[model samples]
Target: MSNGTDMALISELVARERLFRARHNPEIRDCYYADATVATSWQQGPLSTFIGAESKEVDPRFVIVGSVSTPVVHLNGDKAYVELPTTTHMRMMVNGTLAELESYRRLIYRVERRDTKWKISRLTSINESDNLRPVIVGQDLHVIPQDFNGLRSSYQFLAYVRQAAGGQISQDLLGTDRPEEVERLYKETNAWLRAGV
Candidate 1:
């Protein structure tokens, strides 16, 4: 049911997932930049600031557990593309409560051989969506997990608004306003999270 190369790619993906589980923020930082192009999405100023603020509040001990069920591999000459099309279950303790999320991520890993060693040239997260509830209130309050879920379910209906308007709307409406966009994305993403893939 699989080829040797397929097995190798799966092994690579598994290794990366393990690193994520290690929850070593520094390692994640390094892994994120193992290649220049791979880190482009993260270099955005506001995104950087967001990460900086979140990292301070998030404990490295938080655990994320998940699995890879279906993997699609495509090879183009020297470049190989791998897509993980399976459901993943990730749970981590946030603010003293275990917050769980289910989502699917499609990732691409590029490999090259130099001398006798095979080196990963680049790894790109092509697309990823998670179905996790929003942690904060409508961009205003910092609520614990229990509180977040309680209120979130009541207003979960707002997600359709974000999905219909798209991220660009949130950007335009909340432009230059850090808190506004953060709240918009949080709400939009929550709507998708509640949708459940």
Candidate 2:
């Protein structure tokens, strides 16, 4: 990028790719390469197929997207690494009571420039925290704090919501609940980026 404007545009590409999902834009599928993969707290598989299935399963009326900060992009010729800080604000009914859940996480992406086109080769999510609160003051969401006893506190509320929505949590996902997992993920991603992948 030769100027601030150019850098800003380049940085926005990553965030825009994610926002597309919030908007239910079909073009989001175009942001990934043919073999691209996406791993999250509840799902891991080919990104395109995941998107297609998720679109069919997830309810559109409850879709929520808060905001995404400008992504930090590291360029290395044809390979790139990106980090996007994101907040997912969602509202759902918990046992007939209205509740809100906010999941704080970072989205990491491995991008590649092929044939003059930049596409995400791999995308992974690392969760830091989750908060759940009743929408009405002095009311309960019918969920007990102890219900999260065996769950990772870093993504407890998110996991609960996923389970409530019929989604399964994967133990293999990276999260702040396990520092070693975070370290290993970074180590492997950095190595992949440095190796000119």
Candidate 3:
């Protein structure tokens, strides 16, 4: 396909991703390649983990309120690379007060033409910044403690844990002395993470 066509297809796919994030619609998965992979700056593991992290029910208050710039695309035959820079402002009600987080992210998508259709084969995201200031919005305004610093977000931490478990499984499969123990730990860790989420 021509470069313009490739760019258009990739741009559409990125827009679809944003829509999917806001809506949490499972049908959006159709836009991805069957064996697509994803890696993010703040998170590790496969794309499925990221998808699972999204809430099943969309919260009306927690909505994306911002605009995204046009993506820069590079086309190479059947493959296209796209870089999309976006700044998103999310607002939600927390403890009866309005809370907001402004996040800047650059998303890279690798789209490929498969069977006459374009599909995203891989996606990578770089989190530029996530600024969350404490300011109560009510009859009385108070500052809340910012205790979430120096700690990975829940999604990033969980992804690292899952990656570690996978590594342990691989090592155990390589004829480790304590295969049974490693297997047990892997299963337990997986179960614990799943339950916590």
Candidate whose lDDT is highest: 2
After superposition, candidate 1 runs with Cα above 4 Å error: 1-59, 86-98, 133-197
Clash count per candidate: 1, 0, 0
TM-score of each: 0.42, 0.88, 0.60
TM-score of predicted structure 1: 0.42
Candidate 3 has its poorest 10 consecutive residues by lDDT at: 167-176
**Runs with alpha carbons beyond 4 Å of true place in candidate 3:** 41-43, 52-61, 64-66, 92-97, 134-197
| RMSD (Cα, Å) of model 3 | 12.7
CA lDDT of 53 in candidate 2? 60
Q: lDDT tens digits, residues 49-164, model 2?
A: 55876434334568777688878887666777888989988788876778888889998988877876677899999999989988888897778777777788788887777677
- Residues 158-180 of candidate 1 have per-residue lDDT tens digits of 22222222311111222112456
Model 2 poorest ten-residue lDDT run: 1-10
lDDT of 3 by residue, 1-197 (tens): 56776678778888888778667678667878768777653334556655655423223445667567898876666666677887766664433455565667666677777778888777765555556533454432133334333333422222222232242112111112335643564464334324422
Candidate 2 — which pairs collide? Answer: none
lDDT, residue 59, model 3 = 38
The parts of candidate 2 lying over 4 Å away from their true place are: 1-10, 54-59, 165-167
